[model samples]
Target chain A: DVKVTQSSRYLVKRTGEKVFLECVQDMDHENMFWYRQDPGLGLRLIYFSYDVKMKEKGDIPEGYSVSREKKERFSLILESASTNQTSMYLCASSQGTGSYGYTFGSGTRLTVV
Target chain B: EDQVTQSPEALRLQEGESSSLNCSYTVSGLRGLFWYRQDPGKGPEFLFTLYSAGEEKEKERLKATLTKKESFLHITAPKPEDSATYLCAVRGGYSSASKIIFGSGTRLSIRP
Candidate 1:
């Protein structure tokens, strides 16, 4: 089974602080994604990377950025964290095009104060 | 707009009770419908993927059936361990992007 690992299970960040959430996946999948899970909002995609050094903006990419320097790792960056950004961040990986589905990591619960 | 919606925001069932959850979608050219189980304070675990209308997949006490406009996740004789949030998602076949739209999810609770 493919294991997607999120670097942190829980994190607290002050407002205006820079935050980095990291995710790594085995099985050499080509597609990786970052999503924020909130009550009543479901899981909204923040960003996705199809290949190394490639990235695409999803519906909720306003307050975030992403890095995909390597094939196995994808990272979500918050240039300046805010209270509204406090939510569960999920990392997922899939094969190219994702016609199948995705395998998700444990997730990082970020509380921005 | 392409979107997915799950019905019955929350449900409470007994251990031997049987029930089904609904997932309706409006995305054109659907490639796949997925069901995932999410425990509290954790990421979702992939459950089943239905590719086409009339396709059905089963694992353990759970079965999923997909139609062109909706999908149903049926849980039979569920256990306490089955209590969690069930999320449904859809993938757009027309687009090359590997992104999926997810529903808010239905929280299920099974009592002994």
Candidate 2:
């Protein structure tokens, strides 16, 4: 079985504060993704990394960035958190090909006050 | 742009009853369609992946079928434990990588 673990399950941060959400996958998948899920918006992609040091912006990438220094770890960074940034953040990983669906982490609910 | 829409934002069913959830999508070229079950406050758990129109996959009481423009997930004699948010996603087009677009999901509730 594949395991995807997030660094924090819940987090609270003040406005303008820097925040980091970490994710690690044991499957060594080549594709890693960061998504923010809202009530009506579903899961909107924030950023994705296909390989180490390679990143691409998804549909909604404003105020957020990602890092993939290693194959097993992907990190989502909020340069300066705002109240609007509060959301349920999910991390997922998939193989290079388009055959398999993503394996998701438990998700982190971030509250920016 | 690829878009996915799940019908019946919410559903309520009695235990032992059966029903189907619909996922409609429009994309340039379909690569795959996926079904996932998400529990409250948790990430989605993958259920099925349908690649072609006539493909079908099943696990236990849940079965998924695909067509050219949509997919259906049918639950047979559902139990309370089967209650969850069912999500659909599609992967398609040439966007440097395989990017998946997800639907808002249909929340299912089973009454005991």
Candidate 3:
């Protein structure tokens, strides 16, 4: 089955530590997205990459960055993790156009102390 | 800005009870409306996709219908297995890499 895989299911990091969250898609889709889910904010987009090496900021991209060095892998980076950044991070992928539904990863729950 | 809103943040029902969940949205252009079911600690599973008003889709005891302003997911004789958080999302006008907007979600519980 087509799937989006996130490397970590749960993670804990220090306040100033740098964290890396990895995602890989086997569907060969062109668009990959990163979203953070909070209590009342719903799912807020952090960043997304439409093509290899091409990244764009989403609605809530302040504390996060992304890298897509290859077609299948997209990485989310926290330059300096903070307590406020702790949340359930989701990864999703879809074809560039005409794709109906997005295939989402199981999600990574992160905690910063 | 495109926005999707779901009503009744939480709902409780007895097994075999029937009800409907609402998803209201406003967007520049409506490409598609989607319904997903998310069990705790798991990713959202795609359930149905409606492309236009007056469209309907069904699977088992779940049926979804769409209108220009909103969409409804109706459950007929729901079972305990159907308890989960139902999420609604919309894909619309193209400006960003991804145009999909999601609602906060409705958590449903069914008692035996």
Which number leads on TM-score? 2
Question: Which lDDT value does model 3 have at B96?
Answer: 47
Candidates 1 onward: DockQ, in order: 0.77, 0.70, 0.60
Candidate with more favorable, higher lDDT: 2 or 3? 2
Model 1 chain A lowest lDDT segment of ten = A93-102
lDDT (Cα, tens digit) per residue for candidate 1, span B1-112: 7889899999999998999999999987888889999999999999999989999999999999998899999999999999999999998857677468899999999999
Query: What's candidate 3's DockQ score?
Result: 0.60
CAPRI-style quality class for the chain A–B interface of candidate 2: medium
DockQ-wise, the better of 1 and 3 is 1
lDDT of 3 by residue, A8-83 (tens): 9999999999999999999899999999988778789899888999998999998888999999999999999999
Q: Please give, for residues A1-113, the per-residue lDDT of candidate 2 as tens digits.
A: 99999999999999999999999999889999999998877899999999999999998999998999999999999999999999999999999875678999999999999
**Best candidate per lDDT, number?**
2
Per residue, candidate 3 scores C-alpha lDDT tens digits across B11-84 of: 99999999999999998778789999988877788899999999999999999999999999999999999999
Clashing residue pairs in candidate 2 (N, C-alpha, C atoms within 3 angstroms): none
Write candidate 2's Cα lDDT for B16-110 as tens digits.
Answer: 99999999999978889999999999999999999999999999999999999999999999999999999999998865487888999999999
Scored against the true structure, residue A73 in model 2 reaches a CA lDDT of 98
Candidate 3, B-chain TM: 0.96
- Per-residue lDDT of candidate 1, residues A6-36 (tens digit): 9999999999999999999998999999999
Runs with alpha carbons beyond 4 Å of true place in candidate 2: B94-96
